[model samples]
Target: MSTAAEIADHKSSVRERVWTELRKVAVADSRFHFDFGEFIADFEGGEEAVHRLIDHSFYRDAELIFITPDNCLDRLRLRALQDGKVVLMTTYSIKRGFWLLDPAKIAPDHYLYASTLDGMERVGQHLTLAEIQATLPNVDYMVTGTGAINHEGVRFGKGHGFFDSEWGMLYQIGRISVATPCAAVVHDCQVLVEKLTPDVYDTVVDIIFTPTRTIEVHNPHKPTCGIIWDRLDQHMFDTIPPLQELKAMGL
Candidate 1:
């Protein structure tokens, strides 16, 4: 078994290699300059990948979807709204907690704008953890953008635990479950052939959609433990309001 340090080091190396290759191909988002922190969004075939996801059965069947705030997923968010699917997403880094985007409430003209992080605040309603538990229905599906991922379903996310925390909070509130199908959308270059070790808190994906293909895992690792508090420090607890709120409410 690989030690924690070894696992982290391997992930770092993979991230660096993938990020470098992505830049070489000019797939990296230009807005962020050279350093594509937390992986590059708007990569080559990104729109095509989103289109593929929209065509998938899971996406078609889902009424409510939890998508991350990664810039690459902006198109997915927009499509979800245009399709009238309820979107539950976190602010960048979950710094501001969860926002619920209801297509019915947003104007058709704003669909394009509302899909963005900045635009979400304008059209989406912010919800507290308690409010989320009281009102939101079970999330039908979940999708996120990744720094790098392997065929085995292991994911690395800009060294931040935002996605895991988001999953943990939702799982703790019974908003999502073990049966919820999770997926990752990325560029073909982001998919690694080498083995990647998953930490206990890592959330493995059931499906991977790239611009060119869809790869499904035989048996993805799903972490049942919600919110590994021991692994979180005071800084995280203090910075992420949702975490503090969840802990305070004893959720």
Candidate 2:
């Protein structure tokens, strides 16, 4: 096994390499298939499979759903609409991290909805854009609990830091308190044992959901080091206007 510092260095390099691969693959796939959607639909029950993945967390009782940024599978979350089982899922927000997409339009008055940073809004029990905007640092709605979480060690899309940036901003602003449970769903093929060098700003998830099973992490939160004002990157701070305002207010 490599030392902690060495593992971090290796993992950082792996992250970069993986991002390059995903970009190239995504681009090539897009070019050859102008109607990739139609092509995917041709597969026996491919559409249904997509729906299954998106609704997985909801079926597991996830109140908040966090979807990936890839446009290819955007419509998968619409299948979870069962009356009384409303769930909210986040999409790319014009401002930052993610915004909730309506869980009902696809199913009718079947689900509830909410919004986030950007102009991103959706159907179902809508939380006024203003309310999400006013989320305070110490609010209970923003808090999460600590526990063993898993990422399955799968790298996200090209690792542009959007996910990390969004989580970090929420954490800094006190939106997602220290206790909120977070996890990533992935195929078992995505798990990695490599060392991860998490910076002070990195927000780790509490669990990893695989197609077959769920892996629990024991302790998820990291120790707090001093804040690095200069270290705040564009992706992290720019998406959150409130974060900027808070900083100006003396962050």
Residue-wise lDDT of candidate 2 within 138-232, one digit each (tens)?
A: 32221111111125323332334445544554455445555666554443433455545455555565565544555656676532422355765
Measured by lDDT, the strongest candidate is: 1
- Model 1 residue runs over 4 Å out of place are 26-31, 38-40
lDDT at 237, model 2:
68
- Alpha carbon deviation, residue 149, candidate 2 (Å): 12
Best by TM-score: 1
Against the hidden reference, what TM-scores do the models get? 0.95, 0.55
> Candidate 1 lDDT, tens digit per residue, 1-251?
78878877887888889888777543444456656664346677788889989999999999999999987899999999999999999998788989999999999899999899889988899999999999989999999998889998899878877898999999998899889999999888889998777777789999999989999987888888888888986788889999998888886
Cα deviation at 185, candidate 2, in Å, is 1.7
